[model samples]
Target: MEKQILLQVEGLSISFAQYTKGLRRRNLQVIRDLGLTVRSGEITAVVGSSGSGKSLLAHGILGLLPYNASMSGEILYKGQELTGRLLENVRGREIVLVPQSVSYLDPLMKVGNQVRKGRKTAGALERCRELLARYGLPPDTESRYPFELSGGMIRRVLISTALMEEPELVIADEPTPGLDLTAAKRVMGHFREIADEGTGVLLITHDLELALEVADRIAVFYAGTTLEEMEASAFQREETLLHPYSQALYRAMPQHGFQPLAGTQPYAGDSYEGCVFAPRCPYRGEECSIQEIPYREVRGRKVRCIRPELAEMSGSPGKMDRSPDAENLALTERGRMA
Candidate 1:
């Protein structure tokens, strides 16, 4: 049976108003035309490098963007528009966020109070203890403050807190950064358990390999946009991935020669005429510079490249010349300075 769509985002764009030199105001377009779907009982991993707008997507969904930020797009929850009062109502109840930073936890509050959200009832305490214990945290951990816990313990605490509420959708932003390999895998296992029990999980992380371990679908995020989205199994082989950036990521893995992708991602406000990844793409062509690259389905996979076919014609794995040319180097430096 097909799982129900829990969350749907379409044409999502986010821009922040910033004052330039001499008080000149400009809009820094951080995320552009991003879209993804999360189905109930499935985990959708939005994988990317840092500053790829993964965390911003979570903040935008919960209406937690900064005051100067402006968002224009459709965010739907269970077939209904999620905005204004509706968004506020579901912000931390039906929809929960496992924030990236441990600073999100109150430093002054004890773990028990924080996890149960200030509810002092006996049932809430019992539930909190159970949740913490489920994540390998001991019962005595409840009396300690966030500052007292180690990084890995704090990460587990955040997950335990998010699970305190029976949320329909859980948006976890880089939830395993501070954890050891064993702890990270354990945390991912918990997410899989929830997904198995019908909770839609949108996992935001830069660790592509870790995401592949538990995610049902993988959405490859580039500079402020989605480059490709496909099944996690597509990552098993480079050819299965449709986009050059996705293939490059697969090749960069430790098991796949660790071939570094050259050139830097464009800054938030940098202008792009066509595909953003063209500077680092081995299969880049002249048409990539001028043609409008639309996010479309190519050979049953969703991709955002005009010349995805070129990847196949290029050659065997690890053979593509990814060395940066003079032009690409100049462009990368310009993007960094921007």
Candidate 2:
């Protein structure tokens, strides 16, 4: 069966207006021309450094940007544009956010009441129990307040609260920050289970390694925009990856060489032409900094680099599959050739 596109974001730009030293106002754009699609039954992980606007993307999608923040983008949910009344209606119902911080939990409200959102019905009570139990929260957890629970427990409670409603799309922003390895893996596994049940999960995380483990697709965010989006399997080898920054991430992984990339990402307010990554990219040419680089498709993936082919020519062995299906065909062909 063909997968349904649950959420689609196109040309998303978010900027905040602020006063400078002399009280002069300026607009600082954080996210620009960002685009990605989340399909039902799939986990699409957006991985990037902490300050790369990943959280802003989540807030933008949920229509939760502050009053001073100006946003321009087309956010479509179930093929309909999510704006005005539509966004307000589904902000917390259809599309739920598992925020990065557990501080979202109410300090005064009890765990059960908070999870059920004050519903006293038997079904609500039962579901609250099940969700809490599923996350290893004890039965007595319902009676406790947010301050009484551990940080990891509070994180689990936040997840349980989000699951209280059958949300069609789940935007999890750094949901595993305070969780231990086992707990984090378990949480990610639960997300996998949620997606398998036909809910679209947009996982916003800085943990590329963890994202690669469970996400079907991964979108690499950088300098407030997506640099590469491809199948998770494509990250098996650096050569299989397209963008240089993505390759850098692959090398930075512990299993790889743990080699850190030189230079820092450009700040949001700093103005410069060309690719935001040109200053650090090894394959960057003069043209890369002359103009704004357009995101384009290359080898069955979306990449923003001007020279994606250089990764393929970097002397790494083995050919990459165009898609998951193509990977199987390539393997079969290789077997036959042998």
Candidate 3:
């Protein structure tokens, strides 16, 4: 049995012109040469800080970007190139998005209408009730308008609508960022349930804990490029993260709080021949400043770094996978001795 490939994004690049009375600049490249794949059963969490273009990437896929923006890339859904009307046709059916805000719901419409409108078919409408019920919302909440629903109730509806199509892939962007811990857990639980049903999920969140809790794979994005991608378990392990940028991020977390790698993010217009994170990386040196960001090859991890130290990364405990080095060595030595 094979899990289906739901969506494939290749060479996806997006740019927007920026002019805020700054020293004359033509444009800013937001996301560049970014590639990602979502199989029908995996949840790939795109984690990064604010203004890091996580949401922009999701917007690029949805065709929701501003008209002034330019995007060039391939977005394939179920082996078909996603484009114009066909995109509109399959968007709700094969792909769905749960935005960060529940207010995205139409205030003028009843909750039922909104949910039913989530999908075009009568089957979807009927399933709307089922979805609401599944999330523990009263069936009657469907009859009420958006304003009438509580925050938690509205959140449930927003999630249910995205599930209406029984979509093969769901792109969730910080779906629980503002909610309380309880609400966030419940929301993450919904995604987990969706995944269990054989649907693929690309869960995008800055909350590393949230990503770890729900994601099977993690792709850490810096500036605009992928630094390192590994299994959720590897995120905490110091086994070796082959990129200096990712190492800086790994250290920046308060959980680690190791050293000061202080510097601002590179301006989008800056000439980044080297790694985008080079400036803030304390380990960076002469080679870094001159070299183009090289993509290093590894078994499973993609390291967009030139001075990648594979041995150091293979088992560095991430903020989550904090095991003492001696214990890990003992286990490895035992395996080798066996």
For model 2, give the RMSD to the true fold. 8.7
Please provide, for model 3 over 203-256, each residue's C-alpha lDDT reduced to its tens digit, 9 standing for 90 to 100.
Answer: 878776677788887787766656777777776744455565555555555576
Q: Pick the candidate with the highest lDDT.
A: 1
> How well is each residue in 250-317 modelled by candidate 1, as lDDT tens digits?
77787987666667788899998888888777777888988778888788767899878888565366
Query: Which residue pairs in candidate 1 have backbone atoms (N, alpha carbon, C) closer than 3 angstroms, thus clashing?
Result: none
Best first by TM-score, ranked: 1, 2, 3
Worst 10 residues of 1 by lDDT: 329-338
Q: Total clashes, candidate 1? A: 0
Q: What is the C-alpha lDDT of each candidate?
A: 0.85, 0.84, 0.72
Arrange candidates, best lDDT first.
1, 2, 3
TM-score, candidate number 1: 0.93
Task: Give the candidate number with the greatest TM-score.
Answer: 1
